[model samples]
Target: MMTANPYSFRKVALGDLDLLMAWQSSPHVQKWWGAQEPYTAADLADPRVARWIVSYDARPFGFMQDYSVHGWENHHFAHLPKGARGIDQFIGDPDMIGVGHGPAFIRTRLQALFDAGAPVIATDPHPDNAQAIAAYKKLGFEPSGPAQETRWGLILPMLLRP
Candidate 1:
């Protein structure tokens, strides 16, 4: 279970909030991450967010959110169709960048999602976020070939299972 190959997701704690926020707001991360409005401590305090801690090799490495489960539609990915799960994640720990865990981590989660009955998994990111776009492509995510000229509308499709 501690192996990097079979990634497991864990619930996050209040103690991890600050570290998570720091990563969310960091300039280094802004490129790969979406520009969500600053999440107040009170926001993180929300129980509905259902945050999770991401690990690789038994080491806690980053964070992930399940917005497709719930949230405001226009802003976050809550607009994703029912039965679709939206995921937002990051390598919160500074030392973990470029460690080569992201693609596999996403792959594992997508597999888990598909196994759970999600027929389609969608991700929306800034079109200019080249590295992330590249990474997703490498993982078999293909564009729906639609763009809205906004950060969204850049739809990437993932075949969760079968």
Candidate 2:
């Protein structure tokens, strides 16, 4: 049996813009993530965020991004420790949902962050996004506070401490 994780992540690049745009436009993705403008060169070069393409068994099927919790002024997670990170992700391939890839890839990414000395990791999923909330819970995230509206949307703050 193959014991190694099947998920792999690669830094998203300019060349991936078309693919990413298509994924972002998918109905399932658009529902949760909203209409996002196309990423610009400056957006991709932003120092505080790391965007990735997630693949399972070498097939790209998702998008994920991690950012410094305190990168933006008055960010809800700013109170977290200095090295804390915030993550947002979605499985873009409709076929990949409910098949275990969300938690699996998220686990792999979170492990990498924790191993690199992140004191905590945070995620803010919409309160009604039960699937997302359940997956986060399975990965050990717990509610840090009540749901609140932010520029991004209404989210339930959750955190995973290393």
Candidate 3:
């Protein structure tokens, strides 16, 4: 039988801004994440967003953020149920980018959300981000529908019901 992933998550704090900024601007993360502008303190402090630092074997390696779908302004998923949430993430460590770590981290994060009463979790990745789409699918996410336009850009909506 498959074993549970051991990734751990820590609540992001202001001190992490510099680290977040570095990852946000890194070529590996930026290529797919499209960090148009530096993330501001206000953005990290948004009440609607829950940001976390993802670590493996006690080593920080990535970042993840989730928001209440129904609480976000002009959110395409505003129609979802109250417990619905949306997540965005990326592995910042180039050495850890690819090696079957993404799906595990995502699955672990989803489990935490589900345990916290979120029945559904959603993500929107740029249509061209096939690798991200595939990784999300491996975590049991399915395309919710056609592409949608958002302030960030065009993305294919995917959702997972836990």
For all predictions, the C-alpha RMSD in Å is 3.9, 1.1, 2.0
Candidate lDDT (C-alpha), each = 0.66, 0.94, 0.88
Query: Could you give candidate 3's per-residue lDDT for residues 1-162 as a string of tens digits?
Result: 996567999989889888888888889898887765766779878888899999999899999999988775788888788889999999988899889888888888898899999979999999889999999988889999999898878989999997
Task: Output the number of the TM-score-best candidate.
Answer: 2
- A best-first ranking of the candidates according to their lDDT comes to 2, 3, 1
Supply the global lDDT for candidate 3: 0.88
What TM-score quantifies how close candidate 3 is to the native fold?
A: 0.92
Q: Which portions of model 1 show Cα errors greater than 4 Å?
A: 1-6, 32-50, 69-81, 149-162
Tens digit of per-residue lDDT, candidate 1, span 55-150 = 876788777775454454454444555676666677777787786777878777778778888767766656676766777787777665554454
Structural similarity to truth (TM-score) of each candidate: 0.73, 0.97, 0.92
Q: What TM-score does prediction 1 earn? A: 0.73
- Candidate 3 shows a clash count of 0
Steric clash pairs (candidate 2): none
Model 1 has an lDDT value of 0.66
